[model samples]
Target: MKNVSADAINALKAQCRGEVLLRDDAGYEAARQIWNGMFDRLPGIIVRCVGTGDVIKAVNFGRDHELLISVKGGGHNSAGNAVCDDGLMIDLSLMRRVNVDPKKKTLRVDGGALLGDMDDESQLYGLAVSGGGIISHTGVGGLTLGGGFGWISRKHGLAIDNLISAEVVTSDGKLLTASAGENPELFWGLRGGGGNFGIVTSFVFKCVAIGPEVYSGLIVKKFEDAKEYIKFHRDYVRTLPDDMTVWMVVRHAPPLPFLPNEVHGKMVVVVPFVWLGNEAEGKAFIKPIQEATPSHGEAFGMNPWVGWQSGFDGLVGHGARNYWKSHHIKGLSDDCIDKIIAFGDTMPSPECEIFIPHMEGAPSHVPADETAFSYRETPFVLNIHTRWQNPSDDKRCIAWARDFHAATEPFAKGVYVNFLSEEGEGRVKEAYTEAVWERLVQVKQKYDPQNLFRMNQNIKP
Candidate 1:
């Protein structure tokens, strides 16, 4: 990192429209905090960007000073690349703004906006974009850049599938628009290339008519029955329609109202799903899962779409030491199901979970080579979400996740970029195919050849 002079800092403060904070400033401490508590870094300077102008100035300043720069947009990534030590941090938390065009069924969201920010505004008109994830506080920018998916993804598509355009600021401080008609190559890269190319100031997404309410809920099965239930689930979801999505989670059960007191804190297989269609049809589709195995408890009915989006917020709340390992699997083999059950039995912390989300519907229908995201045909994504609060338990928690992930690696074909931690270059390559990786490298060479935006899962020029 370069030593920035006091004069230059003052000049930057005078020119920017937003707050500038140094280590000693009032909001500096708060500004440096991100979703994962595992990373505790101290950036030399933090710029709270309010708009595109501030982002341009900050990017230019960071480049001119030759400083290590990190960009923070909702700061929810598992890798914690949103903040860096001894360098410039461009904070975009203040730029959250969402504009919905009902007539066109599209929305333009600022880079800083959270998934909740977009959901709240769009749901008012009974419209939404796919791939915001289950957590509402997740950032729209990070999610979309890494091929986002969520409850509606099976019906609509991945977040990148809905992305229509983006306003980007390159390393040289030039603002440009990327879409199918303009800078088409950059647009393709932005769909799933992570944040290596540039800083997207805003994004325009094509929305689908989803809901103000939807049929969704959770079903908890006993750990004793997990082995059989998982095998059944693996085949059951394949028969369902795209309008319904069911994901499996193996973890110690939370004390929800519906579960028996004896089941609380016990390892269980929880199936959560969302259906875009009406209640009766949704119930008919979910009936098989309900009767698949003798469940310990279950909850299913109509729920507010926005409410369901943030339903798991409490379990995944920020400020926990989180380490994640993930893989893309075509199907859950018998051996894979056994490993998942075995890991769930020995979970280091109650917060730790093995998340297996069913994929392959609308997104899979798109050709693999059409965009930088190449794992379109993957039918399942397994995420080893290891979370704990105590620093002393870090080694145990991380090791559990790693061992579990390694045990299941043989069954996996690829991995999700968004679910990755600070794993090395080799692991990053697993997120893309050879052709897509080569194309992404070319785009990087054109827009950011010097690699100023190396804080993300980088594709080097």
Candidate 2:
């Protein structure tokens, strides 16, 4: 078998233009590593694709060789579906380029480009497509496919909402483009659909005018004020207009200087917001949040969008152990708030945090079935993220997150597949309802009947 695999690798080398890393290659070790340390799969080969042509060759080679295949964009998936065991791993990291057409206010991005890269390039023109949150390092592929959320989401919608078109490579090793006018069914599936249908090489997105600078910052309140802060948040968020978006977290406060020493490692509601308007208007919009509750200390000010993008840099990263669970709730009822606060108070690790962000904005107004994102009507989404630095603490962190989700699932209206772990097909189907699930299955069959794009939160074709 080893000899046969080696011969197949040689055959691929002769047909491909880019480099391929076998098990013994130095690059193989690096290529196999994903954002989540929990996954440690050793693929037979890691093909670092330099272009769409290389991607096509790699896909066909893997299919012909009967090897399991995984497509990695930014390699940021918590489930580590980016690489597989004893299969062909197609790494798209080298295809990082962004072409922004300022005149059309549109941007074309290589699927491997990170949100940070997209923001950095787009912001130069005082324009930005909707992108994932600050950790800017998140790949465009995973984020966009799984319904991206970030600072500008309130104004523009999910990252998928801004996607105008995409160039995808199908299972048959053919390059195809999908948009509203062409391959419309495939286009709909690409948005929030996860990477279940094809390999997206390039995506064209409609850019919106936004920050060179924006009024965005954070406010921290003590642990004792968790309930009050949440209550105030619920009401305050309801009143805020579409131009403002805020996400509140109750967690052990990181020991930043602005955070009082006594408050570190204690539960607190870290309220972060980005107001998309003039300073005066933005300040007016945020005034009530400050007056509504007694905050521990505030980090409020005007900053560049990139600075605001970096605000959560301390929170998100690759290589850390990631176990994520999430819920989309219709509202923050008292029972739900109590459950959240209870878990918040007993957070198992400093890195363990609960996120509840309002979803009732212009972005949320879109029909649930319009795209692959089906939970927009869900008023709030809660994320229980358990992140730790050491493998020894893995079980503890995962148990804490799972328990939190189990306790709160009764109040949850739906689940966000992007933040989910490998819970199996039933859970995947639950992420979309019977009707939506049926449609997704049909679309999956249409574009990828062989299920070649099953590497993601797979919807079986």
**Global lDDT scores for all candidate models:** 0.92, 0.83
CA deviation > 4 Å runs, candidate 1:
none
What is the number of backbone collisions in each predicted candidate, taken in the order shown?
Answer: 0, 0
Which residue pairs does candidate 1 place in steric collision?
none
How would you encode candidate 1's per-residue C-alpha lDDT over 36-101 as one tens digit per residue? Answer: 999999999999999999999999999999999899998999999999999999999998999999
Cα-lDDT of candidate 2: 0.83
TM-scores, each model vs. reference: 0.99, 0.97
Instruction: Compare the candidates by lDDT and give the number of the best one.
Output: 1
Q: For model 2, how does the per-residue alpha-carbon lDDT over 1-461 read when each residue is reduced to its tens digit?
A: 24245677788888777789888887788888898888989988888988999999998887776677899999988878998988788999989899999999999999888888888898899998874655777889988888887877877788888888999988888899999998988888888788888899999999989878888888887778778878878888888877888889888788878877887777788888888888889888878888877888888777898777766776776787889898787788889889988888777777877888777775677877788878777778898888888988888888989888998888887788888788889788767767788889999999888887777898988
For candidate 1, give the lDDT.
Answer: 0.92
Error of 2 at 376 (Å): 1.4
> TM-score of predicted model 2?
0.97
